[model samples]
Target: MLLDTFGRQAVDLRVSLTDRCDLRCTYCMPEQGMTWLAKPTLLTDEEVVRLVRIAVTLLGVREVRFTGGEPLLRPGLVGILTACARLQPRPELSLTTNGIGLARTAAALRGAGLDRVNVSLDTLDPRTFQRLSRRDRHHDVLAGLTAARAAGLSPIKVNTVLMRGINDHEAPDLLAWCLERGYELRFIEQMPLDPQHGWDRSTMVTAAEILDRLSTRFTVTPEPAGRRGSAPAERWIVDGGPARVGVIASVTQPFCRACDRTRLTADGQVRNCLFATGETDLRTALREGGDDPRTDARIAELWRAAMWGKKAGGGIGDPDFHQPERPMSAIGG
Candidate 1:
């Protein structure tokens, strides 16, 4: 296992298949759209599979998640997932999607050995959904969720980004809906990952506050996990059916203390920190075909540097610190 400075072992890798997305969320992708990485910089399907192989064989990467500006946009996504599933001692493979194109692809992805899905859906109301997602596919997204369930994707996770005045009031309602549907509803604390979206901490809502609100309706209690890494979502069991709820406190509470995640950008750059200022380009090593020893040495050196740069806690203090990169979508959150 690749352990960091804080002794957090790297077990999961969130890989971005593409830097392109369909909808432009208010808090994520830029309003006027942002510049994307060049196609040549992006990792090919074979290169991505190679990286995953190395990560699992060498770095103890046991869980692989395909994310993106929207992973569904990648044409070869299903093929990549199939390859991961067929790996020796295959890791748990999953994908995070906006659910725009999920209806058509859910069954195909599940057939490809995708364990499950996490769909980004902040608002249940159609108008609010369109306002937040900048798309009029609320019904389609919901249909995607239904398709996921129909495809037998067990324990489907619906991610809700709680922005104050935007979807905060709908927390209880969303909780009720998830409980009824047997879906896991996860509330994510908005971070300033992309400052271009005009993120202000003042508008941020704390996990504690969300819990306090949720507790008014259900008996909230912690759910157990073998190991909780840097994902930041403190899970809980909720009322009605077997539905669960999780709150990812990245802003008010950072999980960097136990963060074991490494992000691979669509352009083949391995990012040590989600909010990291520096990224190691892995494409160069992949292209230099002749020297295996040199390639391995370079990748290892980059990994060591990234692990060395990991902090005891990220976003613990620096209230005024603005992340230079775009938010989760652009960075494959």
Candidate 2:
């Protein structure tokens, strides 16, 4: 197993397909928008597939999650999924999308071997959704979720990034709506991925606060993590039905000690930690046109180097330590 210095086994990989996003979420992308990564800088489908195979075979990776500015933006996404499904020890493949253009591609994605999906939905109010996402694709997102359900993506998860004074009031309402629709709801504490994006610690909310408010209405019982490969959300079961709620407290309560994730940027930089400064560039090795053995050596070597960058904790509380320059969108939030 490819265990990092922190004792966290690198079992799941989040692969970014592109740096270009259609929406300009207030917290994620700048109002002027983000600079797109050059086409050549992004990994080709073949390079991505090759990397995944090596990661699963050599590094004990058991799950692979495709993410992006919107992974659906990649024209070769279906082919990528098909390649992932063909890996020797095929990892549990999944994708996280904004669902802007997912309405038509939902069935195609499932047909191409995607195991499940997680859609980003912050508010049920159309106007609020538009303001938060900076796009009027809320209806498309809903349609996409509905289609994903119809296409057999079981236990569909919806990620809601809560911001105080923004969507905090929608928590109870969001909960009721999701439970009624049979969607697993995960409320995430927004992390400071970019200082330029204007993140204020005072405006941030904690997981405990979310639970405290939620419990006043519904009795929440601790639910087991249940599976080996899962996101860093302390699961809970509401009083009624099998409706499960998850809370990801990345900022207020960092999960660095238990972080089991490794991220590969669309530009082929393997990052061991989300808030880490340094990264190992895999593009250089791929561009050299080496044979299989040489290429694999470079890949493994890069993995090891990045693993050395892992910290016991992210030190997110440090007032002096600002986040790395990349925005969450560029890092596949």
Candidate 3:
């Protein structure tokens, strides 16, 4: 186990496939003048699989989630999923995507061993979706969600980010749409991961605000804490039924104490936290070090050392808190 100084073992690994995305979401990156990672800097499909294989088989990682600027944009995603699924322990595999290409690839992804999916869907209104994403493919996303459901992607999770004056009013409506379709909806507080560095805590929505908005329509009940188990989302029973809703209060209610996630950038750097200013270069080790037990242990040791140095929390509320140099796209989800 990659145990941190805080005694939190990293059992969940978030591996990024690429830093390239198809959509130009307003909160994620600028519509133009965005400089993407060079092709040579990206980890090959083989390298990604190798890292995940080691994390699962050697380091006791149980769940592996593929994230990216948009994971569905990776051309070789099916092959990567297939290789990771073949590991001896067979880690639970999932993906976080924007659902642009999922309409065509959902079945293939499921067949290639993807367990479930979490898609970013900020607004249900077509024009709002286009406005938020700067893409006119709102119907494509809905089709993708439907395809994922048909492909047996159990618990199809929808990730919604409510920006101030931009889709903030859709909380109740979003939850209602999700509940009707049986998609577990999770509303996330916008963080300071935008490339433009325009995130303002004063303007961002809060979990309390979301629940208060939701309470106007649905009876939200908090699920017992025991069932949460290091998951970021604080879940709720919607109207006291099987259908559920969640609020990931990352900024307002930080979960650093219970965080079990370790992130891997597409360039093969090990990120101990989302807001980390430092990164451990596992890519150099992977390429320079030979494939052997000694090399494997050395790689694990590097990861352990990275985790050991993790700060107590993301330090969002601190007066001197600094946003990471890399935006969320570069750091994965």
Tens-digit lDDT track for model 2 on 157-232? 9999877887888888888899989899999888888537578778887898889878878888877555423468
Which candidate number would show the highest TM-score if scored against the true structure? 3
User: How big is the positional error of residue 293 in model 1, measured in Å on the Cα after superposition?
Assistant: 6.9
Q: Would you estimate the TM-scores of all the predictions?
A: 0.92, 0.95, 0.98
Error of 2 at 52 (Å): 1.0
Model 3 C-alpha lDDT per residue in residues 1-333, reported as the tens digit of each score: 888998999999999888888889998989988888888888999889888988998889999999998998899999999999999999999999899899999999999999999999999899999999998988889999999999999879999999878898899999989888989999999999998988888998999999998999999999986998798999999888887898999999998999999999999999999999999999888888857657777888898899999999999989999999899998998
Native-to-model Cα distance after best TM-score fit, residue 319 in candidate 1, in Å: 6.0
For each of the candidates, give the backbone clash count: 0, 0, 0
By TM-score, rank the candidates, best first. Answer: 3, 2, 1
Per-residue lDDT of candidate 1, residues 167-187 (tens digit) = 898888898888788788899
Q: 1 or 2, which is superior by TM-score?
A: 2
**Model 3 regions lying over 4 Å from their true place:** none
Those runs of model 2 whose alpha carbons end farther than 4 Å from true positions after fitting are 195-197, 224-230
